[model samples]
Target: MYISFLFSSFYMKTEYVVLQILVLLYDQDVLTEDAILAWAREKEGADESDKVLLQQSESFIQWLQEAEEDEEEEEE
Candidate 1:
């Protein structure tokens, strides 16, 4: 209950809000480094925090890549 409430609150904040936006934008093939960084900067209020978002974005991409690879391996 506590963590659920915390997560619900977190989605209301600027950083998480921006991250969600970036995720949706990426899914729609409109995401770019400049665009994501710009949003992250506006939300997080620091360039360094943009790096954190970059890392998170990269991790999400990597997970998607690995999931595809796994599916291919399973099919073969």
Candidate 2:
């Protein structure tokens, strides 16, 4: 929910740029693939804004889903 608000409130001012930001954030470790996948898959308790953001991020989600996510995370 918070992630959706941040992207929608800050990034979606002029044009739809959620996909770009998602890639950047995921690459930068600001967001993990698990986190993004979980949020994107949420259905119950999601508000309209969340639904909108989820819809806007469909392509990114699809791309993430197709990628090899089998690597185990390293303990930090």
How many clashes does each candidate structure show, in the order listed? 0, 0
Pick out the ten consecutive residues of candidate 2 with the lowest summed lDDT: 67-76
Give the candidate number with the greatest TM-score: 2
lDDT of candidates 1 onward, in order: 0.63, 0.75
TM-score of each: 0.36, 0.59
Q: Which candidate number has the best lDDT?
A: 2
The TM-score, computed over Cα atoms with residue i paired to residue i, of candidate 2 is 0.59
Q: What is the per-residue lDDT of model 1 for residues 1-76, given as tens digits with 9 covering 90 to 100? A: 9999998687557556656776788778887644654554465555674566555455555555576678889999
- Residue 16 alpha-carbon offset, candidate 1, angstroms: 1.2
| lDDT for each residue of candidate 2 in 1-76, tens digit (9 for 90 to 100) | 9999988787566235777788889989999988998887784368886587777778888888776343433322
Q: After superposition, how far is residue 58 of candidate 2 from its true place, in Å?
A: 0.5
Error of 1 at 18 (Å): 3.5
